[model samples]
Target: MLDPLRLAVGTLTALPVSPPGRIDRRVAGRAMLLAPIAVVPLAVVAGVVLWAGHALGLPSLAVAGVAVGAVALGSRGLHLDGLADTADGLGASYDRERALDIMRRGDSGPTGVATLVLVLIVQCGAMAVAGPATGAAAVLAGRCVLSLCCARGVPSARPEGLGATVAGSVRIPLAVLVFLLAAGLSCLLPGLPWWRGPVAVAVAYAAAGLLLWRCTRRLGGITGDVLGACVETATAAALLALA
Candidate 1:
């Protein structure tokens, strides 16, 4: 359990932790499933930022931006880079090799830059309207998609890299169970309409599913970048629905 937790924290956040001694499918699967729990500290940071902003009478937009930035920093901006790379890959060309090559270059292009800007705007703006609790929920919602992405049978786009290591690591049942748990918890969060939490989650999943389908068709399968892209996409959709 501690090994899985350590793997999750080490991979998902910039927080310091001892690396797991072994990383097999079992450990990776458990780590992905534990993604939401692992990100709790980062979520708390976001919540605190929002709460502090409100208490200090700071501009909601500015505070929300800061909170989003804080999470990006906490996670080492891996998701944001993934989002950009995925966008670049999808927009680059229909040829799978060409698209993958573009993503491999590790530099943002016009399409990637534009996508990042638009997504960040959506995230920050949505956070401003959603308040502290919902904002934190949004953060967890982002990581929850990691389980779904790694569910058994989801192939990797490449033979190596983070995506290949974790791809198809999680069982489908386990992924569904995590989704249900996340939905239930979201619904139970205080101060929001009962429907809001579940609806937000549903929307996030729907958006992520669409992106996954597109990536499977376009890039051949999920990559590390694709997983990151899903995280950002789900986070934004969840926040928007909550707002």
Candidate 2:
């Protein structure tokens, strides 16, 4: 359990954690279950930064940029890489084989570059006018997509790699429980009205679900890139909804 938690935080965030040399599928799957644990600190930091920025009399737009910058720095832009790759893969080809090949090519295509820029713009813009709580809730809502992406029965696009091992990490019951808890917690974030918290979470879930379905049809299954895209998409959508 500790190993999964460590691996989850270590892999997802810039925070220091000594991960095990060998991570089995069970461990990887559990890592997904604990993914939200990794997100809490990032959300808190962003929220605090937003609050501090407001108190310091910084412009709301500047505060929004700083909040986005904080999470991007902390996450090492890991998920953004995925978003770019997935976009490149999907946009470059209609054939599954070719799309998957393009994704692994490690070069950003026009689509990937364009999407990355656009999504970042949307996220930053939304966070700009959002309250501290809304900023925090948006972060949590985005992270909540992790549970859905790693839920049981989701298949990997490839036979091996990060996606295969982490696919179906948590069973439906546990995933559902996590989603509910995360959803409930999201409401506590300040910018949005009481009802918007669940709405924000739903936006993330809808984004994740939409990505999963599209990837399954286009790429044959989910890849690490796809998962990355899921988080990025959810983050954008949740922030917009919350904003």
Candidate 3:
């Protein structure tokens, strides 16, 4: 059996996968099953930092902002990259293929930059108001929803890239299992009302689903960057709604 941690790390990070192990259908499906496992530590660390900041007399807003930035760094700015690429692709008046070409380019355009700023601003503002537990939950929920997007929409798009490679390989049941696990983890937050966490997760998933549908309609599927974008956008939306 493949180590779940290895698959999770390989999938979540841009770190080099030694030997570039073959990701078959079962492996891809299993990878989705493991994605949420990665989120558990991330959520825990963010929550601890937020709580520690409050306990240490640090301004909640400052702490929240730093916490957000820290989490972003841990993910290696993967979602930010996605958010920018998706914005560029969506804003481009060129054909979908050309827009995708623009997105694939390593440069960020005005629209992309603006979208990134807007997302961070909203996320920070929400975190400041909602306090740490809710904010952390929102972030975790958003990550889970993004994983769902990879398991569902991206795979079906059959695009000629990462989306295609991973999507068709995973099974739906395993994907759902991962989402449930992530949701369960979100509920573990102390002082966070039980119902609220699940409700927040549902909202995040709904928003992500709609956004993914729109992106698929426009571009016929999602890219790795688009997946990252979905996570950030959904997380922001969830935080705003919770706030």
Q: Put down candidate 3 lDDT per residue, 49-155, tens digits, no spaces.
A: 88788889888788878878877877788888888988898898547788778888968999999999988998887777676677777767776764567664354
Query: Could you give me the TM-score of model 2 versus the true structure?
Result: 0.95
C-alpha lDDT of all candidate models, in order:
0.93, 0.85, 0.72
lDDT tens per residue, model 2, 124-221? 89999887878877776777677788788888889988888888776889888878887787667654577788887887898889988899889877
- What is the alpha-carbon lDDT of model 2 when measured against the actual structure? 0.85
All candidates: CA RMSD in angstroms?
A: 0.7, 1.4, 2.7
lDDT of 1 by residue, 98-121 (tens): 999999899999999999999999
Those runs of model 2 whose alpha carbons end farther than 4 Å from true positions after fitting are none
Off by over 4 Å in 1: none
Candidate 1's TM-score: 0.98
Choose the strongest candidate by TM-score: 1
Better of 2 and 3 by TM-score: 2
